[model samples]
Target: MSVDTIYKVILYPFITESIASLKAMTNLQGTAGDPFIDNVDDFRFKGYAVCSDVTGNLDGVIMMHHYPETAIAIGNSVCEKMFDEKYEHTEITEELSNALAEWGNTIVGRSTDLHGRYSLEYNFSSPYFVHDVSDMAKYLAGVTEVVTVPITVEGVGRYYFNLLVRSVDYQQVGIKREESRGIENTHTTTLETSSKILLVDDSAMIRKALKRYLAQLGYHNVIEADDGASAVTMVASESPDFMFMDVVMGEVNGDEALRQIRAAGSNVPIVMLSSVTDKVLVDKCKDLGISGFIFKPIQADSGAEIIKDYLKIA
Candidate 1:
């Protein structure tokens, strides 16, 4: 709830990466530019990264805005750094956008760790590219303060990574985040929990990612079913110990699938995985008897731990 909470979680990562990029491009060990508190005065992005909408209420809705030229540039730069040239941004704006997006995400994770005990969590938005800063600034209606992290990219020029923090008391917000506590056997409990797994998804890409993430965590026995109908079938047949069920699909979606599973007398742990987290959708999920849920782009270790908890792994 404290204003300093945001800084404690995110500031170090943002500042370090931005400064390193500036140093590489400028070949200078000093600061790039003054880390200013921008009043949302016209910003721009250059290379390749596109902004995505994360979550939370900034005007009761959350989104990431990138000034076109600047964003693209940030994107390209970030692409180069995070991956190979194949992922490099074609435009400078994209480079900037990607760089900043990566930066923001990293900071969000860091902040999550810091404020976890306080019950504060950040739901990041997708980085979206826009050429007009004024238009984007309109969305910052409820944002009390935004810190523009200044960095001197070695030779590429001076750019910024922004932390749009809207403060609220940790106790005042109503949101559910998994408990961040763990015992010394954290790593062991994660890998040994190879219980029944249900894969309910219409998209192969998403399913692929989930499967890969799980496999990497050493959960090799997996079951994949495309729609709600098939998901029910899998639940009965596989009797999976746990599942990664998506919310939207062609014939039947997550809600119906979950309802069907419950109706069929299945109590296997199921995590509602989806790209969107709308109130109506969540209500439906709650109605279906699903106690666990995870959003799209699952993070490392989380799925494994959730599965363990649901399956009661030793």
Candidate 2:
């Protein structure tokens, strides 16, 4: 891998509600950490490392390293978003650890998929979390080059992403020239000026980003809802032509919201948004009558296409 590819993967999955809030604070305080910089020699022992093996055309191990405080902060934030509960740093229970590990797996697995699309077939092992950095260093003893991307979460310190992989020829792997262009620009589609759209998510950053994206695509009458219960109310009152809902939220999740909406006999087109892949939940959504699924962090171009295709917009 390329540094840009790694950065794109990390940006989408890790930048949750709490992380986005921290990033905004860092921007205002002028204490933001450096963007993904390579510094393998200065790697010091200070945090938790979630390690996973990568196998295929490019063989190596991927590690997500976060300072203990950062890990605890992220874990607590995730718990609050998912379960509507607060957890202190001292309450680092197995439940929190498992949640963190699952998060790690989702990020690594999605990164692997990005690599695979470039013809670099890769598979990741189950994530293993360790509190000591020495264990992570030992695992990468023989690896020569490692790519480190440092992310600064305001309340917590900096978190790092380390990738240790064997060298490979990008051209030989069949990566296309256009595929390396990173994220594509959003495509504008013609739609009725009166068309209404509803965005449902707990994260302010995500909701804002989606609204901006919709504005770019010529859809301005967009309404926002913070959680599932609120989303249900918006669907009834706003009567939007389309809705994009986040799967994970406090109180009522996206699934239950859809259930309630359908139970009330509303036939508005709905798309489910999520960062993780869960077949059972996806099948359940289909049963609940969701029109489509969009994975987070939503790409402008792809998201616009989903709206155009699913809603039959010109």
lDDT of 2 by residue, 1-314 (tens): 55666444432333332243332212211132333545556656556777767666556666777777777777665544433345565655766675565456446544444444544445666556778645756765666557665666555667776666554333333222111212111323444646898889876656765676677668899889989999899888879887889877767989999999999999886878775445567779888877667654443334455445444322
Predicted structure with the largest lDDT when compared to the true one: 2
**Candidate 1 residue-wise lDDT, 1-314, digit = tens:** 34344334444433453344333321234253434454644433332222333244221222233334544455454444333243435454433443454444433333333333343444444334445545655546566656555554344444455655555332343222232221112222332445657778865544654676666567788889989899898777777877778776668878888888898888765667654445466668776766455543343335445444433323
Record all residue pairs in model 2 with backbone atoms less than 3 Å apart, i.e. clashing.
none
Clashes per candidate (backbone, < 3 Å): 71, 0
TM-score of each: 0.42, 0.47
- Compared with the true structure, the alpha-carbon lDDT of candidate 1 equals 0.50
